[model samples]
Target: MAKVSILYPIFRNQQDVLRDLKTIHNQTEKDVDLLVLDQRSGKNKDSKSRVLQLFPKVNWIEKQFKNIAEMMNFGFSRAASDLLIYMPPNIGLKPNLVQAYSDAFQSSGMPGMIFADYAEVLPDGKIEEKRLRDYDGDITERGNFGYVKGYSLKAAKAVGYYDEQFNRAEEYDFRLKLSEHHDLIRVPDVRYDVFISPEKASEKMSVGASKLFYPGEGK
Candidate 1:
């Protein structure tokens, strides 16, 4: 059995989907299973077909939905691994990231999650520091940690999967909930190059800004 399951919920970005899939497949640790959830349905048939051709080994789950959270919840429901990583389509994995996560999981047991620092690359190729804002604020005083960045897969069932109500900051809220039970360690050795696409950033901002108005509705 794979030690970790990477749940990638795909929408309409066919151009970069293959690259994302390839990045996960090329991870240093071979014990990770890539679960690609196709939420594009009929409109994404061409994209799905292309993805299947590139990675026939990947476990593909097709769903017709406009709600991103609903599709993610469905994907989590189908995951078979104890550890689950909820990630965006634009993020690329750095070497040893999976191993680092696995090692952290073994060391801490239940409620332990391993996250790492990341570089935010702009369209002009300028790199900026990326900070992970969760719960109250940056938990850097927690330990052996650099600045926090990127998503993580750890103790899925124990931490409780992403809330379907939050299509935007689901990972943030989920991480906050996980922190309640598990201690988050930001490993400096493992890092991911998270590209901030203008389109995606805009969409996320819109969802995040509106989430405040909705309150617990996002939970």
Candidate 2:
């Protein structure tokens, strides 16, 4: 069985979906699965056909829900692997991310959550690996872990998955809950690449300004 399952909750972004899919398929860790939870149903279905053609191996699951948190919760509940990484569409992954995450789990004695630093990719092609504030509730409470990701099924079930009540900042609340029991470990390596887009009204929906967009960030 694959050790890692990357859950991608996609709404709509065809411009780079195919490219991103290829980036993930090429990860160094062969024992990994990518599950795309497609929420772009009916009139909003834009990139479905293209994605299927470019990446037939991807496990595509379709559902209609405007709430991002609920979509992520569904993905979490359905992940076949014990460790799942909740990510969004159009982001790039480090070739060694899956292997790194698996190793982190083993090294930490299989902790509930494992996260690493990330290099933010700007439109201008500048990549910066900003230092992350290692797992601290007070800091986490004010701002979700910037680029960290991943959680174990055992630990997730104990605290309950992302709260549907919060489409925004759902991760912040979820991480805070898990912090009560499990310790959020940090890996210094940069594992994920996040590209910032123009501001949209949806950005405001985050539970608060201090929310994690990636499930990996909640912790």
Pick the lDDT winner. 2
Quality of model 1 by C-alpha lDDT: 0.52
lDDT by residue for model 1 (24-69), tens: 6775366777788776666666666887897776788776765656
Per-residue CA lDDT of model 2 for 112-185, tens digit only, reads 65453443433343333344433332212223343436777777778788776764345545554554444332
CA-lDDT, candidates in order:
0.52, 0.56
Which residue window of length 10 is worst by lDDT in model 1?
Answer: 134-143
lDDT of 1 at 177: 45
10 residues in a row with least lDDT, candidate 2 = 192-201
Model 2, which residues run further than 4 Å from truth?
42-55, 117-148, 167-170, 184-219
